[model samples]
Every structure is written in structure tokens, then in C-alpha cells.
Target: MMLSGVVSAFEKVLIPVAGRISSNRYLLAMRDSFSTILPFMIVGSFFGIIEWVVIDPTGTVMGPNGMGLGMKMTGLTGEAYLASAFVATLKSLQALCNLVVTIGFGVLSLFLVAAFSYRLGGIWGGDKFSTALTGIGAFLIVTPQQVNKVGGFSLDYFGNKGVLAALLVATVSSWVFVKLTKNKKIRIHMPDTVPPAVAQSFAVLVPVLFTLGGFALFAALLTWFDIPPLNDLIYKVIQAPLMGFSQGMGFSLLYQFIIWLFWWFGIHGHNVTAAIQNTVYMPAQLANQDGTASYIFSNGFFEAGLMHIMGLVIAVFLFSKKESWRAVAKLGAPAMLFNIQEPLAFGLPIVLNPILLVPYILAPLANTFVGWLAVSSGLVPIFRFVVPWTMPLFFCGTIGTGSIMGGLLQVVWLAMDVFIYAPFVIAANRIDDEINEE
Candidate 1:
């Protein structure tokens, strides 16, 4: 009775807490903002593939570490591979693609600023478009504008470096703009004869000025401290420590613990844990792009691609006698290719079922271990690309890691998980058979 009471109270506390976090506005805005631009990021990945295989065959993707997937594909040998990969025809194509990636990822902060500004701005009854634009202006005001040695204007500040600044600016600026504009005393009131668009633009002009002025002051304070740019300040002070916490085998164990614990209790674990992802893993991925090499477990690593395929293999070969498992196997096969497991999780009914927990939890950890080992041992390239969450199994692995070995390792892990799940599958099948016979 005491144990039952404890369990009851635990559920009472956990459920509401999870629900509240899952519905949090800032977290939702960050998630939706990412979701909005994820497609363009994926398009950028295609260009990254070209750059990896065609423009620069010298890197980890197809260099000695990757066993030369690009070299084999193009049938180019020695200096020929390096020389021809960037020949004029391919050079132009690569240049165009790189520009797209720069626009996609290099100015990722801009997209995020626009997206979250629009999202948070709607709450204050603001004009979403104007508020979003003003958020960009405020972000630019705060960032340091630099000129390169070649006399070219540079704004690397608008790229991954500024993600944290962009998030805060977008939310604060848009909210502030809305508050100031909605006040009758401050807002410009045009006569009824004026067109709505022109009047709305003029109405926002005062609010935009105030928002930019506030940011300019914020920038000055940072400069007073001799701080590097705002992005560097954010990276050193906030993102760096959070990212440090996200590293190591222990972090993976802890993250897996949270993800599964919530998932077992019927909460969407990732949705609630979105804040950690935005703060830690997302920065880790961007840092990976900026030449940092040690980040083996970013969002890309946690997003396992073929774990579902392994489940299907276990269901088919081992659980043939269990009609329910087989039914779920067929239904889950498609979603599995896309890395979604909800159908199997609910339909196979793994949640809260003691019989299935061992395999359910173990499969992902097994996959993670195998993948981490492969990357750490240099048998596969560390995944540096932004993998779209819903991309299919092999494609996700290849595109994400920029190596054929990465895709093959996913297949290897898929097979390993099937073997791991085999005993539990057999046990479940036997129980089903016994029940049917009875």
C-alpha cells in the first residue's frame, strides 16, 4: 500500500510537470522556428554532398578515413580526383550550392530571428511581419559589422555564431515593438483616407526606432567590457557550458534516461526535452560546421535512423507466431524507414509493459553505442551535416555523415539491434502461443 501510494504521487507530480514543459512558449517557438527552416537546411545538405564528394574529396568524408566513397563513385584517381572535382563546370555548380548553404546555414540566425519573432510577436497582437523584420534590425544593431582584409563587408555574425543572440533578440524586440505600437499615445494615427499598408508602416517606424536604439545600447555595454562580439559572448558565457554538459558517455546515458522515462509514462520525451536540445545539441552541430572535430553526439547522433528497421527484422524472423507483433511490424515498416516509432510504440504497445521494456529501451542505446564507437574509432566520419528528422534510413545516414560508411554502419547497428531483441521477441512469442492454446 505504501509503494502504491508513492507511485500514485509520483505520477501526479510527473504528468503535470511534463505537460507544462511540453506546452512552454519559448520552447515551442524555438522548435517551430527550427521546423520552419529545416527544409531549406536539408536542401543545403544536398549541396553539402556535392561539396563533400565533388569539390573537396580531401576531407574526412571521402579521404582515407572514409575509404574514398567519392573517389570510387567518380572513378577519378590520385591528383585527378582533386583536380577534376573542381573543374570549371563542377566549380560553378559547387559555387552555387555553397552560396545556398551559406544562405541556409551561414545566415541561420536571420531565419531564426524572423521565425521566432513572428511566433512570439503574435502573442502581443503585433503585426507579425513588421515585428519579425524589426527583430532582424535589432539583431543587426547589436552585432558587430566587420570588413575583411580584401575590403569585402562581412557578416559572419549573421550565421551560426548569432543563434543565441537571435533567439533573445527576436523574442524581446518583437514583444517590445508590439507593446509600444499598441499604445495610442505613441502610435502614429493616420487619417481614414490613408491606405492601410502605408499607415501601418509609419505606425511601426517609431517602434522600430525605439527597438533598435535599445539594442544599440546593449551593444555598447558589451563593447565597454571589451567583450568579443555578442555571439562570442553568448558562446563563451552560456552555450559553451551547456555544450560541455552535453558531452561524454555519461551525458548520453543521462539523456537516454530522461528520454525513455518520460516516453514510458506516455509523454513525448523529445517534445518536453526540446529546451536541452536547443541549448546544447544544436550549438554542438553548428560548432562542428565551424571546424570543431570532437562533437560525436549532436542532434544528428540522437536521431537514430534505422532502429525501426531492426524492430521489423526481429518481428518478422523471431516473432512469426505472434499475430499482434507481425501486424505491428507491417504497419511500422514504413514509419520506421522515416525513423518515426510512435506506431510501433503504441501499436506494439510497448509503453508501461514490462515484457517489452528491456528491448524497447535497449535498442536505441545499443544503436547509439555502436554509432559512437564507429565514429570515435574513425571507422566512420563524424556526422557533420544537418539531417532532416524524417529523411529515410540509408539516405539520412549518408547525407548526414557525408560518407558511405556512415550509411553502412546504420545497417550494421540495425542488425545488431535485431539480435539484441531476439530473446525478448522469442519470450513474447511463446507467451502469445501459450495464451492462444489455453
Candidate 2:
């Protein structure tokens, strides 16, 4: 539904504008599609940064001494500080804001590091150029201890600007490479009739090659400079994005795999919720609370927990045309409770449904806003307590946010979810009924 609206709006608004610039229908269409995708990429990149840089720095971006600043900031307060309502309120809000900012920063940082590394690799042609590999490396190496040390040494020569020096070197090197290669275009020849497997392989290989080339170029640049070892820079650049992408993809795949596993055993896949909670969710909770580890797990549960479950399931249930209501029932029970529901998703047959894809992406984003509000308003506690993900929804809220009021806010979230999804459900059910009659 959300996606439909976006598409509709884009056709009405963007298409006309694009048509004026390009007389060719194909070019106009491509331009419009690109324009539509740009916003999502930007927004995704922003949230990704938050998750990596701010929320889960320990796990995502931080080095050994990264928490020093946070510790120093919090150390200024004592137990007595918690006693003051004003201070408590401020601290709570600060923590929440910090988490959001960190996650956003982390995601953006990943993109920056990747983009820079790609450019760097292209300049030097140093090693196997793989963007994914180099990006993973950069993420690992940019930790606080390493960054501070590099920055500190650089500062000794360049004043407080040594860190800036590194950033500058990275930026300039990347810009030059992009300028050289940006205009080059390649065309692949595929038979008009191709086997499915061959087509799929080709599809996968294109991106893989691009990534490798990007990484190799970054490696080459490092070797040329002899400033930072190509291997070290590449390693750090690659780690965070690689981990984040893999973790997210792995959890998603695991959820679906568990659903199938349960169905084969004639048991509902709902129990997989507990597994997710124990594994990914619980670790996220622990990391958020760990004194030196807080940044790494910031809002981990919210993104990995509440949003993931709700976003995909809700989108499918609302837009599907098969067993819509039944699917909703299957999903809503565990979703409302444990927040897991892949069985419901498969039943809905929503995987490729165009109309439903919109909300699948947007609804979780809407939930993010709600979570942010709860934190900012002090209605929910900022992340403080480390609890299991399978903990009841209310408890998860209370402990994750660190306030009783936060627990109470979960009720509001429940209400919001129902409200947002109900219309879509009704629409889906009507569609399903019509299809059945046909």
C-alpha cells in the first residue's frame, strides 16, 4: 500500500518531470525509476549508519578506546544524578538520542568508508579489487584505538588535522578514480533465450565482479601510498558492512528456514521466535548494556526485533490475495506476542506481490518513528537494561528502554500496528475472496 502510493505519486509527479528531460520513453522510465530508488537508498544508508556508527559501535565500528568519550560523559554524573527528575529525564533522552545518532552515523560511516575505499582501490589497482572485501576491512580498522592513534600521530605533524589528513587522502583518491572510470560503460551479450540457471548466474556474477574490482582498486591505492598497509585498511573497510549485511541477511533467511523446518515437522514455525530471541536478539541486548559495549548494540532489538517482524509480515498479510485473514491470524498471534511469523508470510504468497512491497519496507520505518518518539518523550526508557529478546513485549520494552513507562508504551505500539495494518488486511481479504470466486 505504501509502495503503491509512492509509485502512484512518482508517476504523477516524477514521470512528467522526467519526460520533459528525455524524449525517449525508455530513458524517461529509467530516470523515473532511478529517482524513486534514490530516496530509499539514501534513507537506508542513513539508518545503516545509525546502526553501525552510533548504536552498535562496539560491535560495528568502535575500537578499544571508542567508549572513552561516552564513559567520560556519563562519569560526570553519580547515583545522586538519577534521583533528580530533571537529570534523569535528560539522561534518558540523551541515551536514546545517542543510540539513534550512533546507528545512523554507523550506517553512513560504512557507506563513506566503502565509497572511499572503492575509489582508493581504483586509483592504485593494488590487489584483488572487491568493494565488499575492502569495505569489511575498513570497518574493522577504523576503530577508536586505531583511529585515535592514527589521528594522534597525524595531529603531531598536521596539528589536530591528522585525522582530517587521512580523510582527505581517502576522499581525493576516491574522487580521482571515479572521475576516470565513471563514464566507462560495459554491455553484456546474453542470448535472447537463456536458461534460468544461466540467467541467475549472470545476474549474481555482475555485482560480484564489480565488488571485487572496487576492492582491488582500493588495495592498489594503499600499496601506492605505503602510508597505511593496504591489507589493514581493506580489512577494516570490509568488516562492518559485511557483518551488517550478512547478519541481517542471515537472520532473515534463518527465519524463513525455520518456518519451513517447522512445517515439515508438522509444528508451527512460531517457536523459532524463541530461537531468534535467544541468539540474535539476546546478544544485541547484552551488547547494548555492556559498559564498553553499549554503542554496538544500541537499539539492536528495535531494528532486529520489533521492526523486522512487523515490517515483512504486516506487508504480506495486508497485500496478499491468498488466505489473507488466515495468514493474518497465524502471523498476528506470534507477532503480537513473540514477534515472529514467517509461516504467515509464506501463506500470504506476498514474496513478489507488487502492491504489497511498498508497505513491507515502509511500515517498519513508521515503527522506527514511534520508537524514537517513545524514547524522546521519556515515555519509554532509553536503552539501559540487557534482557533476552524473547522476553515478553512489555518487558522487552521496559528493560531495553530502562523505564516502566517504556513498557507501557508498547501498548501504544500495538495499537498503532493494528491501526496501520487493518485497512490493508481488509483490502487483502477482499482481494482473496474475489480471487477464490474467480
Candidate 3:
């Protein structure tokens, strides 16, 4: 009874709060901005896997301590394979893959600025394409230029390190552009006889100029005071500290707990946390890929490591006596293999089920801790690739961490989760049996 009352009180507070967060326009724009670049990131990751696994001379398949797939396939000794023209051809292929990766995810902040500004501008009733262009202009205005080389722009601020600055610039510049465009006094008037494209272009011109100019002025002022570029300043002052805090085990546990807590109340916890995930964990994952940092906990860790639901599904089938439980398990089994938990989460009715809540929450928390420990202790490789959240277990781990040990680790985590859920499944069956007898 106490548990029930406590749950009710928490639900009254949490649901409304979570709903507002999930619906907030700025957060929504940020979330969608990340979503917009996900395809490109995935494509980059796919090519990156190929580069590391199949082509790169210094990578898993061909490196000094690698599996020697190249040596074996070429019918040559390890030293001979390294010297052969075939290795040169492989290097060329690797270069091509790197080229794609360099453009796709290496300059993600640029895409983030455009996507965020486009989405937010549309919401604020501005010309989206022009506003997006203006956002990019603002970003470039504040980004440091190369002083030693003519017509040269440094790409230092085009990557994940510049993400916070990108979003901030996008928000402020997009709002300014929209507000100016909406004002009759600011935007130039064009006759209806003009082609729609021409008229629209003219209408956004003044707003775009002002938006970009304001950022240019800000950058000039920073330079006059000998301050670092805005991107570097924001990263050092705000993003770096937040990222460090997010890397702590305590934060990881709280993050995992809140996800399950929201799930327990039938809220889409992942959606509620989407903005935070994009802003914090996504950059960490990119940093890991770029070799700039070694963060063990990241978006990839959640997707490829802790998102398993198959253990609970297996437990239900093995221990549940209730027909409804078995039926949901059978229906959810296929989806659970791909890490889609909704069928089991809602269909098995894990939501609000006191008996199942312990295991449902505990399973993921255990996985998060174990995964973190494994990576931090060097028992498993840190995740580097952006494996799709729906990618099947074992495979995601293997590809994401670039090691077979990663797949083996998932097997271990799966067994642990099954053990955690089994007793609870049996207890729920017993309760149902008693209820039926009554």
C-alpha cells in the first residue's frame, strides 16, 4: 500500500513535468537537429567499420597484432602483405572511406547549425532555408579563420567539439532572423508581379544580413579584447565541464534510473531525455571515434550495450505461468531480438506492474554498470561506431566496439539480465495462481 501511494504521488509530479519537457519547442528542435544528422553519421560509421575491419593497414584485420586476414587472403607472410601493392590498393580504398567519413560526421557541427536553424525557423514562421543559410553564416562569422594561409578556413570548429556553440549560434541567429523578417520595417517589400522565388529571396535578404553582421561584430569584439573564438570559449567554459560531469558513474546510474522510472509510468523516457542525450552523450561518442577522448559511457553504450530486452522476454517464456505473459513474450520475442522493447514493455504490461518493476529497472542499471566497468578496465573496447539502436544484440556490440570480445560481453550481460528477471517472473506467476484460486 505504501509503495502504491508513493508511486501515485511521484506519477502526479513526474508525468506533467516530463510531458512539458518532451513538448518544449527548443528541445524538440535540438532533438530533431541531431536526428537530421543521424543518417549521415550512420553512413560514416558504416564506412568506418569497413575501413577498420577490412582495409586500413593499421586496423584490426591488417595491423601487426590483428587477425591477419589480409596475410591469409593474400597467401603471403605478414611482412610480405604489408609490402605488397595489394596493401597499397587497400590503402586507397581506406582513403575513399575516410573521405566519406570526414565529410559525413567530421563536420557534424555545421550540419547541426543548419538543421537546428531550419527547424526552429519554420516553427517561428521564417523562411527556413534562408534562415538555415543565415545560421551557417553566423557560425562561420564567429569561427576562427586561418591567419597563415590566404582563403583558408580552419575546420577545428566544424566537429563535435563545437556542438554547443553551433546550437547556441543556431538558436540566437535563427530567432533574430525570424523576428527581423516578421517585422514590416526590417524586411524589404517586393511586388507580387515578381516571381515567388525572387520575391522570397528579397524578403529575407535584410534579415540575413543583420543576423550574420551581428555575429561578425561579436567576433570582432572578441578579437579586439584578445579573447578566444566563441566556439573554443563555449567548449572550455561550459561544454567541457558538463561533459566531464556526465562521464561520472553516478550520473550514468541516475540517467539509467530515470529512464526506467519514466518507463514504469508509461512515459517515453527516451524521448524525454532525447535533447540531453544529443547534447551530451552524442558528442562524447563522436570524440571517442575521433580519438580526442576516451569516454566509456556514451549514446553508443546505451544503444549497443544497455538497450537489451531479450533477457526479460526469455525469462517470461521460461518462468511465467500466466497465459497473458506467455502470449506477450511470444509476440515480443522477435522485436526484442532487435532491441525494440516496446512490445514487451507495454504488451507484457510491465508498466505499473509492481512485481516486474524491480527486475525491469534493475536489469538495465546492472547492464550499464557492467558495461562501463568492462570498457574502463580494458576488458572490452570502448564503443566507437554509431550502431543503430535497433541493431540486434551481439552484432551491435561486436561492430560497435570493433572486437569479438564485445559480442561475448553481450552474451554475459544477457545471462545476467535473465537471472535478474527470472525470480520476479516466477513470483508474478505465483501471485496470479493465488488470485485465480481466490
Candidate 4:
């Protein structure tokens, strides 16, 4: 009788504390932004680069073999040393591949910035490598007004160098923002109604206006004045704020649009996710020149895999509320075994929940940081192995990072999710209780 009384006393304390922790509004906001906005921005930028810089140059040619096929199929043979069909094809292929890889590197750098900013609460001081690259890229892209010209030799034309100058400028801008706002919390005020017309307007107008304005200003400055490096400065200052604003606005609007579409179709956004994965994400893996096979696990296994685990665990604990726990159990059981969570996401209504959002976002960002640290510190091998996306989290981590340490880190993420969500579940139960009472 004494032991039963003690257990009851503990439960009373535990429930309320869990409820309070789960109700943290700031954490919920952060999670919502990270989940709904960050992923889309990253993916959209990637696709933009691919469309603008990559596919424009290469058409359907994937690699050297594709180029060779074009040459052979055209039935054009010439002097091997001269501008032969093979040589032209090779040159085109090389140029295309280089452009793709370089743009990919730039996109990856941007992603790092975005990830770091989110992790650091929407602020990131530039790192040395990223900053320097951004500077060089910006200087090249933004042409300054030429001064003291001997004859007509001005370095104010847009070229490959301009792209580098733009990058550099972006880096510096990010660094400056970080330094200025490090101590302050960023206030994000999202509007309630995001109408389709408004969303579409912003989506088209924002990027176009900013990008064009940046280039035009740089060109005007170069033509009117004799400033040599003015273009670089202009580029740097413009890139960060423009990129951030455009990306943030576009992603939020796009997400809402997608949600609406899903509702109309009576389907979840999983189909969209699958299409993106199959096309954009998977094709990127094939960019590696090495003979190693490319796979879905290459890009997303660690992040998505752990989410599945966390979702399942949370679903298990929250089961008593709706008797949805049994459904969660049934679906989550197979998914958790294979490290997939589409069922949980759709079934559990975790997409827009204020409570679960925190863990959903924080867990992945935290895991990514940990994984990066481990790889950088040589605690784990750089993942070179290719595994299918369908692989379980533990095995995915092991193969993706090429170390058992990655798997261990995944476990840490799973633990974090439990801690993060347990309180949420408890809070949700309390709310349910209040509703029942009412």
C-alpha cells in the first residue's frame, strides 16, 4: 500500500512538469520554422541552381558516356586532333560537368550557412573558408565602374569571377548579421492568411526583382563611375539580405501552397517528397566520379532515418490518448524497423502540431551538427558507401558515415527526441483532460 501511494505521488509531479515543458512557445516556433521552411529553401535553391546553371548547359547528357553517345549518334567524324565531333562533345561534357560541380559546391555552401543559421537561432557568423569563397565569388560577379583606364581595358564585365564575388559578398553579409545580432533574439512575425495570389506574386517577383536589381546596380556603377571594386562591395552587401529575404518568403509561401494542394487532392505531401527524392536528391548522388554506386541513403538517411525513430517512440508513448496508439504501433513498427516515417507523419498529424515541431526540427539539426563534428574530428569515416534509402537508421548511419560512430550518434538523436517529446505528450494529455472535463 505504501509503494502504490509513492508511485501515484510521482506520477502527479511528472505529468504537470511534462506539460509545462511541452508548452514552451519559443521552442515550438523554432521547430515549425525549421521543419516547414528550412527544408524547402534548401531543396528549392538546389533545384534553382540545377535548372539555371546545370540543365541549361548539359541538356539530357549525364556524363562522359552520354556525351560520347551524342557524338557517335550524330555520325560526325573529323581529325582527332582538330575540332572533331568527339573533341567538341568532350569539351561540352567537361564544361557541363564543371559547371554542375561548381554550382553544387556553391549550393552546398549555402546550405551550410542555412543550417548553421537555423542551429544558431537564425544567425550565423561567417566561417573563414565560406567567407573567403564568398568574397572571391562576389568580386567576380559584381562589376565596378572602371577608373583610370589606359585605353579600354576594364575588369568590369560579368563572368565566372562575378559568381565568386557574389559568393564572397553573401558570406560577409551573413557574418555581419551574425556579429550585429548575436545577442538579440530574432523576431519572426508570420501573417495569418497567406492568400494564393499573394504567395504567387511574392514567389515570382521577389527573386526576380532582387537578382536583377543587384546586377543592374553593379553594371550602372561600373559604367558611370571609375570605381574598380565597387561592384564587389555592392554584390556582397546585396547577396545576403536578398537571398535570405527571398528564400524565407518563397519557402513559407510555397509550403502553404503545397499544403493546400495536398488537401485538395486528399493526399499528404508525401508524394511531393517522394518525387523530389527520386529526381533531385537521387540524381545528385550520381555526380560522384568514382565507381561507387549512388543511393538515396547517401544524402538523407541520417537525418530522415532518426526522425522515423523519434516519431515511432513518441507515437508509442502517446498511444493512450486517441487509441491511435495501436495504429501508430502497427505502422510505426514496420517503418521504425526500416527507418521510414511517412505513415507516422500522416497518421499522427505531426505536420503542424505546435508541440511535436520542436523535437522534429531540433532533433535533426542537432544530429547533423553531431555528425559533422564527428566526421570533422576524424571520429568517424567520411561516408563513401552507397546504401538504399530504405535501410534502417542504425545501418544507414553505419554505412552512410562509414563508421559505427555515426550509428551511435543516431542513438543519441533518438534519446533527444524522447526527452523532447515526452513532455509534449504529457501536456497533450492534460489538454485532453481539460476538454473531457468541459
Candidate 5:
């Protein structure tokens, strides 16, 4: 009864807070914007694995001895015509892969600006096209055009470094556009006979122009003061620090705890936390992909390493004396293999169930610590690929890290998690028996 009271109190406070955070317009815009580019990011990382790790003779997989697949198969060494041609072919393929990655991950912030404004426009009832253009213009206006002797709009502000600035510019630009269009006095009302497409374009023109011009003036002021571009400033002052803190074990542990805590109260913890996770950890994932930095924890870590629900299913199936628990495990086992735990979460009644709460939360945290240790100790490579949430257990880790050691690490974590849940399942059987006798 006391446990139930405590659960009710926590639920009262947390459900409302999580709901508000999850439903916030700006955060939704940020989440959807990042989501819009996720497929492209995955495509880039897939080819990046091929370009940097799979084929290159100097890569970790191929070794520094120049004995690549083609060389080994053809029984040829340096300077031979066939070997030289193969090497040239490999280089060409690498260049092509690099092109794909460049167009995708290379201009991530550019996509974010357009996507964020488009989503925000929908939320604000603005014309999506015009609002997106204004957002992009605002971003470009506040971004540096020259970098490292590159004259045209620099690539420096188009990648992960410009992510936060892109979101900021998109929000401000979309707000201005929405507000201006709503003002009847300033709106360019077209004739009733005019086509809707043409009329809509003309109607949004003033809003787009003024919003972009405002950013242009802001950019000019920064230049006059000899200040760095807004992208650089935000990266230095905000994004970098947040990214650093997110990579720490303390932050990962707290985040894991909060996620399960929300889950225990029947909230979709992952969706509720998506906004902050995408905003902070995603940049570190990009940096790791680019090999500019090493961050052991990333968005991929959750899907690949820390989702230990399958472990509980196994423990229940193998060790639980309770028939109800085994039945839920049987039904939930297949879905859990694919990393979906909703069936078990509700069926096993993980929500508000005092017996299961400790293991439900503790398993993921334990997996996180072990996963972090494995990656940091160089036993498993840092996660670079963004594995789909539906990716199966062992393969998720392997594909995410682009190494077999990652799969082994997942197995290790799974075994540990199973043990964690086993004892709890036995305890639950005892409690059930006691209730029956009473």
C-alpha cells in the first residue's frame, strides 16, 4: 500500500511534466527536424564504414600492410598492373562514397534549418515553403561565408557545428513569418479570381523578406563588432559543453534512470526524452562518424547496447516459477528480440509493479556501464551507425559499431541483465505464493 502511494505521488508529478515537455512546439520541431535527416545520416554512415574502414588498406579492418581483399584474392603485390588498377578502383569507390557522405552528413545543418522551419510552420499555421526559405536565409546570414581559404558559403557552418544555430534561426524566422502573415494590415491580399498557389506565394513574400532582412541586419552588427559567426559562437559556448557533459558516465546514468522512471509511470520515456537527446548527443555521434572526436556514448548506444528487455524475457522464460510471468514472456519474446518491449511492459505490468521496478530500471543502467567500459577500454569500437530501434539484439551492436566485438559486448551485457532479472522473477513468485496462501 505504501509503495502504491509512493508510485501514485510520483506519477502525479512526473506525468504532467513529461507530457508538457514532450508536447512543446519548439522541442517537437527540433525532434522532427533531426528525425527528417536521420535516414540520410544513416546512409552517409553506411558508406563511411565502407570508405574508411572496409576497403582502405590503411584502415583498421584491412590492416596497414596493404593486403586488402583484392590483393589477397589476386595473389599480387605492389606496382603490378592488375594490383595498381585494383587500387585505383578502390580509391575511386572511396571517392564516390565520400561524395555521398558529403552531400548527406556534410550539410546536416542545412537540412535541419529547412526541416525545422517546415515543421514549425505547420505548427504555427504559416506557409511552409516561404517559412523554410526564410529560415535558411536567416541561418546563412548569421553564418560565416569563408573558411580555410574557401570563398563561397563555407562547409564549416553546414555540418554538425551549425546544428544549434540552425534551430535558433529557424525558430526565430518561423515565428516572425507566422506573426507577419497573421497581421491583416501588412498581408498582401490577392484577388478572389487569382490561383491559390500564386496567391499564397505573393501573400508570404513580405514576411519572408522582412524576416531575412532582420537577420541580415543582425549579421551586419556582429561583423561591425568583429564577432565570430553565430554558429561558431553557439558551438563554442553551448553545444560543445552540452556534448561534453552528455558523454560523461554520470549523465548517461542519470538519463538512463529518468527514462525508466518515466516508463514506470506509464509514459513513453524515449519519446519524451527525444528532444534533448537529439539536440545534444547527435552532434557527438556525427563527430565520431567524422573521426574528429571520440565519444563512447551516443544515440546509438541505447538501441544497440543498453536496451536489455530481451534479457528479462529470457530470464522469465528460463527461471520464473510463476505461470503468468512465463506466459507474458512467451508472448513478448519475439517482439523483445526486435527491441520492442511494450507487450512485456504492459502484460507483465511493469508499470507500477513494485516487484519488477528495480530490475526494470537497473538492467539498462548496468548494461550502459558495461557497454561504456567495453568501448572506453578499446574492446569494442565507438558506435558510429544509428541502428534502427527494430534491429535485432546481437546484430544491433555489431552493425552500430562496425565490428564483431560489439556483438560480443551485447552478449555480455545480455547475460548480466538476465542474472539481474532472474532473482527478481524468483522473488515475484514467492510474493505470489504468499498472496495465494493468505
Candidate 6:
């Protein structure tokens, strides 16, 4: 009873805090704006399959070890019939991936800026299209574009590395634009004869001018002071510290707890934490592709594969006549195998069902901590590759770490979650029984 009381008290305290955070406009904008990065990354992960499975030398891939269909085609790479065609295909695929990365990770600023401004436009009754354009202009205006001697501008200033600057520039600039343009006097009134499009464009003119001019002056100030560009300055002063803190073991529990807690409340935990993920973990995941990464908590570390073996686990052992559980297990089986958990998340109904909440929230954290300790103790190889979360368990882990033991580790965590959730499942069944009896 006391333990239950303590939990109730904890929830009472936690709910209000989570509510405020989930409702905050700034954080919401950040979360929603950054949400698309994952999809972009997911698309890019398919490209990863091509490079690692097709182009890589035979027997080089760690996990999926049958014949690579892509590698087999390499025989066509000889000059006999047309090696040029094979090479062209490979180059084309690579170029597609390169553009995805360049746009998705490199100039992610555009999405964030556009989303934030679009959102602000709705909130402040301004023109959404104009606000979006102004936000993009403001971000570009404040950013110190670095041009090489060859007349090429480096895209680094616009990529994931520039996220913080993008957030600041977009959020503040859009707010400024919306706030000023909202005034009736600041907008240019067009006669009924004028086209609606021209009138709307004219309406945003003053706010766009002031907002962009402010950024231009800020850039000039940095230029005069001879400091690094805005992105570099913000990265050094703001993002660098957060990145260091997030990559540490000390922050793992707190981070995972906040994320899962959000999940328990029916929120997309990843969305709420998107800003941090891009600034901290995503960078490490990108670095791991080069095979020199030392981080344990890269992209695939907290993947759905970490929980993949759970559906079969419950279907086979945990329940006996619980039709709902059985149905969810069967329904979620296909998706879970791919490490996509929406079926399990909603079908099993982990959200807001207090009976399953304990294990639902704690399981991922337990897996993460254990994975960290395993890597630290050298019990398993550290993951130095970004395995797409959509990959199945043993494969995701092994491919991620390039070690069979890592695959086994994922299985082990699945078993551990089964054990953790068993008692809760029984308790929930008993509660259901009581209600049914009544």
C-alpha cells in the first residue's frame, strides 16, 4: 500500500511537469519540427543496406551472411559486357543517398525553420507561406555562410551540426515576424482590386524586413568581432555542453526515463526529445559509419530490436486465455520483427494502462544500462555502426556492433523484459478477473 501510495504521489508530481513540457510552444515547435529527421534517416538507412550489402566485399557484412544479391551482381562490373552500367547504377544509388543525407542531415535547418514558422503563423494569425519564407530567410541571414576559395559554400553551416543555430534563428525570428506582423498598422493594406497573393506578400514585408535586418546586423556584429559564425558560436556555447552531457552514462537513465514516461502518457517520446537526439546521439551514429566510433549509445542502441523478442515471448508463455494479449501478440508479430513497435505500443496498449506501465517504462532503461555496462566491461563489442531500427533483433545488434555476441545480448535483454513483465501481466489478469467476477 505504501509503495502504491509512493507511486501515486510520484505520478501526481510527474504529470503536471510532463504536461507543462509537452504543452510548451517552444519545445513543441522544436519537437514537431525535428520529427521528420528520423524518416529522412530511415530512407537513408535503406541506402546503408545497399552500400554495406551490395558494394562491400563478400563475407564482409557481419550479420546477414547469405549471398548478398548486390554483391552477386558485381560480376557484371567487369568490362566484358558493360561494367559501366553496374558502376552507373551503384553511383546513382549513392548519389541519391548523398542527396538525402545532405538535405536531411546537412540542411535540416530548412525543415525546422519552415515547420516552426508555419506553426507560428497558425498561432498568430499570420500568413503561413510568408512566415515560412521569412523564417528561412532569417536563418540564412543570421548564418555566416563560409565560401571556399573555389567559390563553393560549405554545407556544414546548414546541416545537423547547425541545428542549435537553426532552432534559435527560426524560433526567435518567426516569433518576431509573427509578433510584429500581427499589428494591423504594420501590414500593408491592399485594395479589393489587388490579387490576394500580392496583398499577402505585401502584408509580411515590414516584419520580414525588421526580422531579417536584425539578423543581418547580428551577423555584422560577429564579423566585426572576428568570431566564428553564428552556428559555430552557438555550437560551442550551447550545443557542445549538452552533447557532452548526453553522451555520458550519467545522463542515460534520466534521458530514458523522461522519454518512456512520455510514452506512458501516450506521447511520442522520440518527438519530445528530438532536439537532444539530433544534437547529441545522432552525430555519434553518423560517425560510427567510419568504424572509428567509441560511443555505446549510438542510433541502434535503443532500437525496437531491443524489445523485438517480447511479442512471441508473451504469446508463448506469459498468458493463458487472455484473448487481448494473444490477439496483440499475433497482430504485432510482423511489425515487431522489423523493430517497429507501433503495433505493440498501441495494440498491447502500453500507454496509460498502469498495470503494464511499470515494465513498459523500465524495460528499455534496463536494456540500455545493461548494454552500457556490457560495453564498458568489454563483455561485448561496442556498436560502431548505425543499424536501422527496422531490422530484426539478432541482426540489428550484430550488424550494429559487427559481433555475434551483440545479437545474443539483444536476445538476453528480451528475456529480461519477459521476466520483468511477467508479474505485472499476472496482476493485470487478476484485476481483470475481479472486475469480470463483479
Winning model by TM-score = 6
True-vs-predicted CA distance for residue 284, candidate 6, Å: 6.1
**Candidate 2 lDDT over residue span 1-438, tens digit each:** 453454455446644544454454322322232233234343443443444333442321221223433334444334433344544544555466555444333233343344445545544442213432444443333332225533521112121112222333344434333333333343243586998667544433444455445655665676577746532343345444444532353444444455433332223233223324333444555665664443322334353235343534444455544555455655565643544343444445333333343444444545556665655565555566654334456666665565666667665665566556655555555644556789
lDDT of each candidate versus the true structure: 0.70, 0.43, 0.78, 0.44, 0.76, 0.67
- Model 5 stretches astray by more than 4 angstroms: 1-13, 60-68, 78-83, 147-150, 239-364, 371-410, 417-438
Lowest-sum lDDT 10-residue window in model 4: 57-66
Extract clashing residue pairs from model 1. Answer: none
Positional deviation of 173 in candidate 1, in angstroms? 0.9
Per-residue lDDT tens digits for candidate 4, residues 87-107, read 465555555654544443333
TM-score of each: 0.65, 0.36, 0.70, 0.36, 0.66, 0.75
C-alpha lDDT of candidate 4 relative to the true structure: 0.44
Residue range with the least summed lDDT across 10 consecutive positions in model 1: 1-10
Global lDDT of model 2: 0.43
Please report the candidate that would top lDDT against the real structure. Answer: 3
Q: 107-219, model 5: which lDDT tens digit per residue?
A: 98898899989999989998887888888888888887775564778776787666667778888999998999998877888998999998988888788778888999999
List candidate 4 segments past 4 Å from native: 1-315, 318-322
Query: Cα lDDT of model 1 overall?
Result: 0.70
Ranked candidates (lDDT, high to low): 3, 5, 1, 6, 4, 2
Instruction: Decide which is better by lDDT, 1 or 6.
Output: 1
Candidate 5, residue 118: the lDDT equals 92
- Per residue, candidate 1 scores C-alpha lDDT tens digits across 307-365 of 54456446565656677778887887776665656667667766555555556677777
Go through the candidates in order and give the clash count of each.
Answer: 0, 61, 0, 19, 0, 1
